[model samples]
Target: MPNQKKTKIVATLGPATSDKETLKAMILAGVDVFRINFSHANYDDVRERVEMIRALSEELGLYTAILADLQGPKLRVGVMSGEVVVSPGDTITFRTGKPFEGNAEEVYMNYESFPQDVKPGERVLLDDGKLIFEIESTDKKEKVVAKVVQGGPLKSKKGVNLPNTNISLPALTEKDVKDAIFACSLKVDWMALSFVRHSEDLMDLQKLIEEHAEHKIPIIAKIEKPEAVENIDKIVAYCDGLMVARGDLGVEVPAQEVPLIQKRLVIRAKKARIPVIIATQMMETMITSLTPTRAEVNDVANSVMDGADAVMLSGETSVGNYPVQVIEKMTSILKSVEGSELIKVPHDPPQIRTVRYITKSVCYHAALMANEIGAKAISTLTNSGYTAFQISAWRPSAHILVFTSNKAILSQLNLLWGVKAFYYDRFVSTDETIEDVNAIACKKGFLDVGDMLISLAAMPIKDKGMVNTLRVTEIESCPV
Candidate 1:
């Protein structure tokens, strides 16, 4: 692999790029993480993909992670008779407590509590805000009456969204639970819970993972609902990661608000020291077109300039006509913004009274030291992968070379910004380990003969504790 761009790229795998040749090209094009959306495929299909990704990544000697995005209680329209053309000012009634296929006049909702939860005069959006209706009244019984404000052709099983309704469904649906457990069995590096509304939503998923997963698998709470934005701090503290699911979020909130919301979320995630991914419709134009519109390019550039740890592609790579080309274009944009030195993430100096204050401070100062000295690399020996995130949070320009004995941790670290994880099991004296890693990093082209390096490790390396040691030295300034 060549010198990696600091900002990571994540691409989804789907029918367009299912073959070995396409998958290998995507990995080579710099897809640090491959997301498997559980909504599309069954467990067997998922299992086959997991096997293929691991096999190819190992063969290519590139570190990669897998994120299993669970499809949570997605509210959708139920069986409506063949497509109906709905016009503006048309009246529609959504019926509940009845098992009947609906037609042009009435439709059924998959959510049982839709009638109970929705209030009169609230707006209802269908199919990603294409069709909008203003609720006139809800009987709080079997039906709700609505008038179409913006109308289009209605398709069966289209998604439903009530931006104002207080939905009663748990963050994780029954299918989500089953999918999560299966993903745990496969030992995916990350799990994303969709439509997170509160901190407790993450807690529920966390508890479930703790019970079933053999090892720690970090959870990324999908920030789509307006309630999730309100509880950002709590959500950041409790979850392992955050993803701005902008497709649904942009529809739920006023469209004008999503840009600032996205920027705020990035700043908060940077402060929290957990990876943040900006996802959804990043390169939607590239889904069918040969090239992206300039607006789409600017969107990717802005995300990178906002200090987003990663930018994710959905339809462009999943079901689109051009999958590998999308990844290549996304990589081009990420590298352009990152090379321009425009990203300035707000640095939160480590605080006192924190349990891991010392470790945090070491990672913080390491970034400062690297910047002041113009170090080529910041190398750390980590057992639990804590120091990598801590160092990445400070937005250091140096290449983050993480040396870990755990191969699983190596792949998992692929999601962090500026990270390039390597494997090393030899934990002798601190100096010996430092020399070994410096040599490896040099061989890997992350360092030059006279380049400065910042090394961090825990004292008494055999214990493999949190990072507590930092050293700066020139790598091979003179022939040994």
Candidate 2:
């Protein structure tokens, strides 16, 4: 019904783009979803933004998605007395102690949580790898001794980085759990987990969601660490979606390898039919300038050309002066590139054998059938966006219209290709489902009186695994 585009755009909200006017502009400029970064805003701020988005959508008679990104266990150096400048030849002491005056010789970490975590021979990076230090001696009572491996001036509360070090820390910190609960209460569409290392990380959060939220929220795993990349298959199985977080990932891994890793991540996710988003600094210069640089434009176009489901804007929209302009530019780029024949990448669809799960097989079969029939569109009523994603992977020419009663489902669909999501009340009967879907089709100009329509839905509403049927019906006439 709606215009079909392969690549979606997710715009982050911050002081620059949080206002109603800016949000409206962003929607008009083609932001498929709005990202609320919990790391920056509080509950009240997010609530207000959500309310505004809902109101704007209602006014425009358009559907949009809201993604709440949870900040997970952000590790940082505790604090320092003042600015501690260290040159190349300086030696620094990084240990737990009261704030004291120090020069190039040594510096003190005022965090009580540090000593228990750091061990001998472990490397600690300061200011996100602008400086590096190796621990020499540990004093549980006094301070630990360390020599600067790389040196730079250290400011108060700069981020700390640990590469290839196994630190014992909870996947979900207290703040993360609290924020997760709050996000569930708000009924957000997607919950992006930061710093996810393994499949168990998602399982733990899923349990917390069940216990506290009493509802299932789709988890989007953010791949910003090496561990997550190494254990990606399991993580993808456990989560609903994946995000290529290139910023911290660039810092954590070799910068030159990020592009290669991004390609691998996208390909792997495509095979599973799981939506993947390319996020962080896709167009960093748009944060200050009205237009993106040539390289940045190429970066975005290349991601779309690579078959990424979506590309996201972080600082470019969150704190950038040209938030609306950036959205417009990205939308334009996606439209232009997606229209070109070059956008079609050859992919070998995986062979799915008949499995014990009938629903899974049904989904695969329906997608194959649609492609073979050369249908103009595929429509499914799904509580999760999985069914739509499965259909999209078939590379059919048809657009996908995923209908749902849950607003959360609509939001999570923002990162999927060829998906135009709509929300309606859960159907109480088969007749209602048919009539509702047909009415929507007519309204959106997706069907004519005699057009053939394919419908897929799970029967017996209470059952979760009942999505195993497809029916083809011809539209008789327009509803009165």
RMSD to truth, every model: 1.6, 3.4
Clashes of each: 0, 0
Judged by lDDT, which candidate is best? 1
Deviation (Å) of 220 in candidate 1: 0.3
Q: Output the lDDT of residue 270, model 2.
A: 79
| TM-scores of the models, in the order given | 0.97, 0.87
Q: Which 10 residues in a row give candidate 1 its minimum summed lDDT?
A: 339-348
> Deviation in angstroms for 186 in model 2?
1.5
lDDT of 1 by residue, 1-480 (tens): 364688898888788867888888888887999999887867777798889999998898887899999998898877777768788999999987766687778998888888889988999999999999999998887789999999898888889889998899999999998999899999999999999998888898999999999888999999999999999999998998899999999899998999999999998888788999999888998889979999999999999898899999888888999888888888888877786755665666887758899999999999988988999889999989999999998988889999999877888999999999998999999988888999888778888878999999999899998788899988664323
TM-score result, candidate 2: 0.87
Clashing pairs in 1: none
Query: lDDT of all predictions, in order shown?
Result: 0.89, 0.77
Candidate number achieving the greatest TM-score relative to the actual structure: 1
TM-score of 1: 0.97
- Residue 326's C-alpha lDDT in candidate 1? 87
Cα error of candidate 2 at position 444, Å: 1.8
